[model samples]
Target: MGRTSDAGEKILAAGRSLFEARGYSALGVAEICKAAGVPKGSFYYFYASKEALALAVVDEHWADQRREWTRILSGVGKDGGDAGGAQPLDRLRKLFEETEAGQHAVQQGCGTVLGCLFGNLSLEMSNQTEAVRARLQEIFDAQVEMVAAVIGEARERGDVTVNDSREAARSVVAQLEGQVMFAKLYNNTGRLSPLWGNCLALLGARAA
Candidate 1:
């Protein structure tokens, strides 16, 4: 029982890594199982098809990322305590900073920026799979709402002047994805440096 569950997890981790590094269309189930160090039968045992595995990978990644995003954007500590009293805009800035740092770390590990898995798959596979397309839409919608909540708070506190918080938040999320795409294209994490400034502008913050 223990080994059975472990095999599924290994396949998931391998799929996520390969999908992020190579995009989805370029990979095959045999290749994924090889990377997972499991037999091809093990793949069939856990996933009905590659698309099903893709959905699993996306869900697992989002579950982890949503936790991190909540902790940072909501200013809640991992211990369920206050997270240093960061203001809304400041928490937003930290999100960008952490993004840059994360890409940099991935570059150092793999010698190239892998961009974002969700964004990469959205471009590469959204047209090919309706399931993946709908899932990606749902993910981005949640992200926009999270950022909009922050923007709404900032507006109430006079920290920003945005009229439509949701629209501004969509712009901010779009900007983040665009900048991450540029970072991957240029093979330079530095391309992400302007995200905070661009976000401030989107929010109509006085500092911007």
Candidate 2:
């Protein structure tokens, strides 16, 4: 039973890695099972189908990413203390920096820039599966809401001149995904460097 449970986690890890590397439509359950070192039966035991596994993978990835985003955008330290009272704009900049650093690290390890998983899956699967499409929409909506909350804080502090924080946040998220797509296309994480400047322009942020 213990080994059976471990196989489920292994399948999820392998599925996520393969999905990120190759996109969802290109992989098969047999391949995932082989990479996971688990029997094909184990996959059926844990997931109803590849789509189910994909949904699970998407949820798991978003959970991790949302946690990191929450931490960075909230200005909380890694050790659970205040991050030196970082202002909202500063926290937003740090989010971009951290994203760039993460992409760079992945490039260092894999010699290829795997862009945002959600963005990639959205492009590939959003049209093919309603389940994935709806899930992706929800994830993106949540992301926009999170950014809007930060933008609201910045507006309150007179740091930005945006009237509609949620709309501005949607643009910010779109800009981020577009830049990440360009980064992946050019195989250069440096493409992410302009995100902060673009975000500031979008927000009409006050001069520091």
What candidate 1 gets wrong by more than 4 Å, as runs, is 1-5, 77-82
Give a tens-digit lDDT track for model 1, residues 66-164.
888888898876577886747999888878887899899999999999999999999998889999999999999999999999898999999999899
Backbone clashes, candidate 1: 0
TM per candidate comes to 0.94, 0.95
lDDT tens per residue, model 2, 4-57: 358989999999999999999899999999999998987999999999999999
Each model's C-alpha lDDT?
0.91, 0.94
Count of clashes, each model: 0, 0
User: Model 1 — which ten-residue stretch has the worst lDDT?
Assistant: 1-10
